[model samples]
Target chain A: MELFTPDSGLVIWMFISFAILFIILAVFAWPAIMKGIAERANFIDKGVEYAQEAKSQLDGAREEARGIIDEARRQQADILRDADKMKTRIVEEARVAAQTEASKVMDQAKESISQAQKEAEKNLRNEVSAFALEIAQKVVRNQLKDEKSQKELVETLMGDMK
Target chain B: MHQRLFRYMVVIMACMILPVFALRGEDLAGNSAAAHEEDKPIDVKEIIFEHLGDGYGWEVPFNHHKRIPLPVVVKGSDGKWHVFSSGKITDHQDYTEDGVTFRLAKEGEHKNKIVEVDALGNETRVTDMSVTKNVCAIFLTMVVIMGLCFWLKSWYKRNGYKVPRRGLGAFEALIEFVYNGVIKSTLKDKAEKFAPYLLTVFMFIFVLNIMGLMVVFPGGANVTGNIAVTLVLAIFTFCFTNFFGTKHYWKEIFWPDVPLWLKFPIPIMQLIEIFGMFTKPAALTVRLFANMMGGHMIVIVLTLLIFIFASFGPIVIGATSVVSVVFSVFMLLVDVLVSFIQAYVFTMLSTIFIALAQESGHEEKHEKKEDAGGGAKEAAAVTTL
Candidate 1:
């Protein structure tokens, strides 16, 4: 029972002592310690947030890298396609040029051949005419042996041609 | 490092041996002194009472004769203060003052009490307001708490909120526990504002309670076991809860949001609600005091069982002593756990009371709505003018 009953003096002392102790601790101790704790917590939060941001940035960069690779692939395919088209065009152009040159050569060869044939005919005609004149000269000389005979022969030849 | 460790072990061994030798010397001297008379039985109750209660001086066994004198202060009926060291009174057990004898009474209801006797032999009290052993313990506890708190404060200042690895890591867990578990769990968003008070109260009660469980100089104060001490803590909670209480809080006590019939019939509910406020603090007071004191008493009684059974014979006493020691050690372990738990419970409950005593609910929303309407109405009236 005495234990249960609190002495007033002790109560007063406790009251004042606790009040002072509480005030001192509340003002001095708690704020400083809590500040430290909050700062640490904030640091941790920032670290996590920074890590997440870096991860997202990495993802974005990876996507861009993929896009660049895809664009390079497309450009490569376009270059290959263009090379194929140009190669065929150059081959086609050479073939057409070669055919034109062959045709021109053939036309020149035909024209030269015709000209040579005409020349040959003209030469043959000239040779025959000369031979005919020679034969007439010999025959007239043997038959008449004079200007009279040549005239006569000329007249005879003209009468035979008429 | 190994050399340093060995040196430490040597120093510890020396300390242990020195204390044993001193105790043995004292026992030998006491035994020799007691050889002159029949050996008296040890009074277990008296030992327990002395340990549980405060004394004018700190007791030590120096040849088992006297105590170390502390200061004693008492106010005389002459309206003046008399200050004297305990050496003048405790050892001699006699001190004369102003025609009255101030001494320790060894009989009747005044046994172990300080009282004054007149020349005619009538005993009266002259206010035994001395800085007793318990007061010394209280101040020591205060010093320890202050030292730790201030030291940690400096540590934080130096380290800049870094998670303390070695310097103050011991306190970090308990501090974090109170803040996160008790303050955040109960006080919600208001935790930060009330954290300082709650943390301080928690540490004060915790250190004191843990010290109370110890059987040594710094340990055996039983400060938390004192009803007045618990009452002071409870009163702080009471003051904090009511002081910061909001309009909605008062409304819960004076005008609850119950049916009109319940509130208007006779204000019975409101009365009950008001009574609840005091009872909550009262419960806090009694719980801490009773738990600490009960633990101390049980441990003492268990230890006393050895002497109690010694009456049967040496063999009976020897067997009972083993059981007594085992049970006592078990209780002491339980006391340690209770000390921490009770401190935590008090802090958490106080935080809860703080939360409950704050402004929350539809009533606050209604108030805000009313304020907004009033502002608008005032603006319209001014415009009309």
Candidate 2:
């Protein structure tokens, strides 16, 4: 019991010493310690927030890059399709031009052949008429001489025919 | 290979620490043995009590004496202060001068009391405000703690808000553990405000407790184990809680939210609540004091067992010494654990009391809205209990 019993001097001293220690610590030590801890906590929290921001930004950049790649692929397919269409159009146009040129040449040859045939037919008709005329002239020359000599005889034959 | 690595670490740590522990025993035994005269049988109980209780000097057992006498300051009946060395008192004898007598009365209930004798031979008592061993220990604790705080501050400045490095790194963990684990969890939003007080108290008590276990002249004084010291710490915590208590907190204690029938019969709840306030600090005082004292006593008693066995014969002494020393060391290790635990419990309880007395943040805001005075003045009122 005496051990627990308070000594007035020691109690007074205890109160003084303890209060002094508490006050001094409150002013000097505790605030500094608590501040250090609080500052560190805030710093760590900020660090974590910044890291999260960086991660989201990276993700956004990746998504945008992927979008760009997709656009490039689509453009490539469009260019290939346009090239195929141009190739087919050029081939069709060239085939059509060659067919028209050959038809024009064939029509000219047919016209020339028709003209030549007409000219040849006209000459042959003229020649045939000349030949027939020559043969008739010869026959008329001989028959006319005989016709004059035979006038007398014809008179007699005419009398008999009458 | 891993187990080998582990063994190597164990060996290295043991190599570093075991010698210090061995030297500690040698230092205490060597000094005590040299100090005591062979005329009287060594009384283990008395020796233990002497070590546990406060004395007029520090106990390195130097100069073939039990203590190195500290300064004695006493106010004499002549209404003036008389300051002298405690070495003035002769061994077990009355010392007289200037018609005033001072004697070291080491018998009866008031052992080591400073008794005064008048010129007419009438005996009286004088107020002793001397720095005794326990007081000296308290002073030492303060010095060590103050030094540590300064070091921590500079570390903060040098490191620039970084986690402490080197020796302070270990201390930072303890500070953080108490802040995050104890103060923050118990005190919540107001934790930062009260951290300085609680942190200081925790470190002071813990350092004092660990010093008690050191069992050497510079290291050994049961400051925290003393009832007076514990009471002072408890009183501080008590003042902190009540002084800063909110109106809501006081209301919960002074009046209860109960039915009228119960209220009229007797304000049992209020009475109990009042008692609870005093008991809270009282419990804190006793818990720390008893735990530290009990642990020290156990270690002493265990070590004393070897001496008791030595009375029979050398053979018995030899057999018991091994067991006794091993058990004593184990008890000391347990004491070391209890020291930290008691310090932690005291700080933890103090925070809980403060938290209970604090108003939740929303209630504080609502109260602020209802008040029709200067916000700062009202805030000050809330903190004045």
lDDT of each: 0.77, 0.76
Backbone clash pairs for candidate 2 read none
Candidate 2 regions exceeding 4 Å error are: A102-162, B1-41, B61-66, B117-125, B259-267, B359-385
RMSD per model, one decimal: 9.7, 8.0
Interface RMSD of each: 1.6, 1.5
Fnat computed for model 2:
0.51
Determine which window of 10 residues in candidate 2 chain B has minimal summed lDDT.
B376-385
Candidates 1 onward: DockQ, in order: 0.51, 0.51
lDDT of 1 at B356: 70
TM-score of 2: 0.77
Question: Hey, what RMSD does candidate 2 come out at?
Answer: 8.0
- Which segments of model 1 are wrong by more than 4 Å? A88-92, A99-162, B1-41, B59-66, B87-92, B257-267, B309-330, B364-385
Which digits, one per residue and each the tens of the lDDT, describe model 2 over residues B155-197?
8888886887777887778888988998886666789788888
What TM-score is obtained by chain A of candidate 1? 0.65
Pairs in clash, predicted candidate 1: none
Clash count, one per candidate:
0, 0
Candidate 1 per-residue lDDT over residues B1-385, each given as its tens digit? 9999999988855753554455446556766654334235778878777667667777663434576777777766666677778878765367876655677776656566677776777667667677777677777778878888888888878877577766367787789988998788656678889998898888888988888776666677778888878888899999999999988789889898788888897898898998988987887888888888888999989988866764464456556766787788899998889889889888877876777776566845676445435533542342222
Q: How accurate is candidate 1 locally (lDDT)?
A: 0.77
